[model samples]
Target: MNLEHFDAIYQRAAERKGGELALESMLSTPLTQQELLSITDDRWLSAFSMKVFQSGMSWKVVRNKWPNFEELFFGFKIGPLLMLSDEQWEAKSIDKRIIRHHSKVMSIAANAQMIYEAGIKHGSFAQMVAQWPSDDITGLWLYLKKHGQRLGGNTGPYALRQMGVDTFILSQDVEAYLRSYKIIEGGRDTKRSLAQCNQAFSFWQQQSGRSLTHISQIIAFSCGDNRM
Candidate 1:
């Protein structure tokens, strides 16, 4: 595919966002691999659960009730959550302290089980994530979608990004840029489209020496109506 140079994209984003300094200030960096390794499995579970609950609901509402989620879910500790009986989980669904969505609430245990198994296999879920190859980030997304509940599509990627994984989100603007360039086609969830996105971002990363997070943000800011 004939992709534009990262420099041109960066320039476009800078101009749109009010010059280089302003755009640079807006870009975010992912945590270092070491920092990712330092995170515990429960925090990863919590991030995943938070994203799942926020999927179709108000983000501010989820954020406001996060503490209740933490408390009721036993601080999202993988072992404790995995051991909860069906009745116990059902109780959590009706609890007044949380969102009370039964399906989303039940997803907590399923995802917790997924995390526990991953921890057993990889020392910790964080190790698996920290050691995942950045160039093949789409593979990681696939893994989460396959193994975890309510983690398909952007849900898993958003959780990963929140927890400092060096992954790009196919947000509306990013998807628009990809579609406009013919870098990807059809739905973003398909393997072919996602692989194409990975290739495009990998190329830009090589060209710019920037993280996927930065490249993704620049692409969004360069196009779309997000500019100031």
Candidate 2:
């Protein structure tokens, strides 16, 4: 990766109002799977509560009910969550209560239990969330089979996409870094690593024995800035 090019991209994003607003908006926004792992507090409850809440409800309704959730869930404490049983789940699952669905409400309780059990193996709830299995595999080969074992849990790729999007400043640097290179339309895919792409680029440059910059300019000229 060209660090200079990457830095320039970041500089540009830093100059954009969309980038600035994205940063501010995502600050208190609910965290993603990756964010959940990175965080060690009841923020998980807070974030997941909102997520589970919205599973069947509209964002607007959930938004309105958010304060109620915070008050009802006690900021997502694991101990308090564990204390909540199937009956308690049903009781608080009242339509007026913050959570509603029986299955989903039961899931919240079950997921908390699951998280707690996972913590036993990983030493902490954060580690359990951090260690959740992913569906994509990573490897030197480009084929899906080679890298399909998936790393970083089933949500790794999803997290990567979120990490690259500048809709939230949560991933501005990532978006900027990738945009700095000729990564093409798609962002730096999890299946394809920078190291692997760099290796390919170096091999291709040597075989072609020509600077890619010149080749690109020539192609751009032939295609025209408007059409290619």
- Which candidate number maximizes lDDT? 1
Per-model TM-score versus the true fold:
0.97, 0.44
Angstrom error at residue 226, model 1: 2.9
Local accuracy of candidate 1 as per-residue lDDT tens digits, 38-136: 999889999999999999999999999999999999999988887889999999899999998999998898898898899899998999999998888
Model 1: worst 10 consecutive residues (lDDT sum): 219-228
lDDT of 2: 0.43
Clashes of 1: 0
* Whole-model lDDT per candidate: 0.91, 0.43
lDDT, model 2, position 199: 46
Candidate 2, 3-28: lDDT as tens digits: 33322322343344256455233232
